[model samples]
Target: MNKSVALTGNEAVATAMKQIEPDVVAAYPITPQTDIVQYFSTFVADGQVKTEFVTVESEHSAMSATIGASAAGARAMTATSSQGLALMWEVVYIASSFRLPIVMPVVNRALSGPINIHCDHSDSMGARDSGWIQLYSEDAQEAYDNVIQAIRIAEHPDVLLPVMVMQDGFVISHAMQNLEILDDESVKKFVGTYKPDHHLLDVKHPMTVGSLFLPNFYFEAKKQEAEALERAKKVIQEVAKEYAAISGRQYGFFETYRLEDAEVAVIALNSTAGTVRGLVDEYRAKGLRVGALKPRVFRPLPHEELVVALQHLKAIAVMDRAESFSTHGGPLFNDLRSVLYESKERPVVTNYIYGLGGRDLTLDELRRVFDETLEAARAGYYRNRVTHLGVRE
Candidate 1:
């Protein structure tokens, strides 16, 4: 039987990493995400997990160490948040392009300028097009569960890519909860052993980890990476289904809340999606036909899943915490518009920029955005400007 125990979101992530039994845990303590690394460090100290824990001086070095461990045919894991992610931007690309299958837990936070340490998606948003599969978790449980699924998705030979498992900073990472920690033996069997088909240390024959390729060969290889990502859809779905069968927990590309016959829908990511879900429940009780769509898989972007979800709605309002700099759009809004543009019949979609600088969004603002999106749908072509939520002059 499955066991349930109270756990902070950061602890839950660390627990899940232990369950996976990675051969190497390379990390540097960064705010918000530090607890996760701490939990893992203790797991090592207590000898619960038999893995080499590498302590690094900086986030960049942490990733560099992970890359080296991964190249040497070990399952590697790491965690970071905000500017820490920004610091590792260079190798973050190399980690994906080289198809290293590293699993990173990013505690979502606002980027620095005036110096803020709160929940926002600016960091991850900056790296959306960086060729890594991104998964946003709604709560601590999904954060724990998806990190395990990330390993399966990234390590699949047909879909060799790194994965970013994002959870809202204080909302999930620092929050406490009763988390059902999976059994170690079961986890070992599920994740299986670290048997890499290609490794730098393999001596059966000579091999290479990463080699520079000229433009002619690089283009085709990059094209192949796209094909690998496409293959990941199947791998991701199948693994989730199999995991559900064993754990009685179900997951999907995107979660729909009362979307079936709704006329308008609100879209969001991370813990904000949970806030929106509660709002959906409140609106549904009052007979308002508003729905919520929380995307789980972002790197693959779940375009097909999103297209299907949009078919029934007349209008959709997308809430984003990160801005795209003068596009009059957010990262998610821009991508969704492009997807719908490719479709023959697409619903009128409106973009709303909210919760910037970690501004707290209340129930009242959510209701207003939903109501305005519905009104704009009937009025034809709404404002494309960022609708700042809870902003003050």
Candidate 2:
């Protein structure tokens, strides 16, 4: 049985966290993400959950504490956003390098310079290569669901890596939406328990977790980490399949909307996918072969899966909420282009950097993007491959 509720993304995550109720939660306050931990603390104070809530002073300390807890064989969790994530950079690598399955809920926000607290993908996108399994949510429901799934995915025996479940700041994080929540008992059963073969707390079998490896062994260890990431792709699918048996909501590396026969399409992540889906319907009604691809699992990269979904298209546009500053294109665009390099036939893909620092991406602009992509597909060449949408001329 399921219960329907109107809850903000943060609240939904907090509710899910309460249900999962892991052994530890080490969190520091950061906007958009602050409410998630704040809500969970209430659960702790009220004795609704038995989680040891550690209040840290900085995001680094928060991540460090989480890593420590996880290394000690405790199921650990945390949340952060924007500069907070950037501040945790050093420990972020350590968390994955040590193969700790720490789950983090990151409310995406722009990295600071001019100092903005609004929604953007820069925060998590910057950490795309940090060896964490990343999941993006289009709404509060997906956020809650992904967090729950993340626990199982990260703790899988084949993929003992950290996970980051991302939601757009202020957009999905603050906006309320009606969602179906699974029963607590079911979530608990679904997530199961975290049993590590080797943990610092296991005094009987003493071991060093963060031991430094010399050059001879460091490279081999990195190769193993890479292999673990590849293994995670299968584990992610398996966990999602198992979760679907309980939740009735199927998940994948990415979602396709009206893409079966689309000649032109836009690929995006997070809440922008919702907007794209609406426009995809409008375009379909107008007899345009346009669709959208919303990537949920970002970290494992899902290259083979994306190639299959997009290889048949005539042209495609990748909308990136963050700039890679490569002067070439954004991170996702580079990935899509690189994946198609070996294909016999591939779409003329372009990159559109949009919605940076919370700039609104209008329907009209999305329509223009699709129209431009369709034109390029027809022409069989790109006039300009990289563009910045909604930016001042």
Best by lDDT: 2
Q: Where does candidate 2 have its weakest 10-residue lDDT segment?
A: 338-347
Candidate 2 stretches with Cα past 4 Å from truth are none
lDDT of 2 by residue, 252-294 (tens): 9999998989999999999999998998898889998998999
| Whole-structure CA lDDT of model 1 | 0.86
Off by over 4 Å in 1: none
- Model 1 scores a TM of 0.97
Q: Give the range of the ten consecutive residues with the poorest summed lDDT in model 1.
A: 380-389
Model 1, span 1-393: residue lDDT tens: 579988878988999998887999899988889899999999999999998999998999999999999988999999999999999999898898888999999999898987898888999999888888999998899998899889988988888899999999988888888877678777677777767788888888678767888986999888877887888888889989977876788899988888998988999998888889888888888888889999998888778878887876777888888988866688898888777775666778888888877788888988888888878667766765357667776
* Local lDDT at 32 for model 1: 84
Angstrom error at residue 138, model 1: 0.7
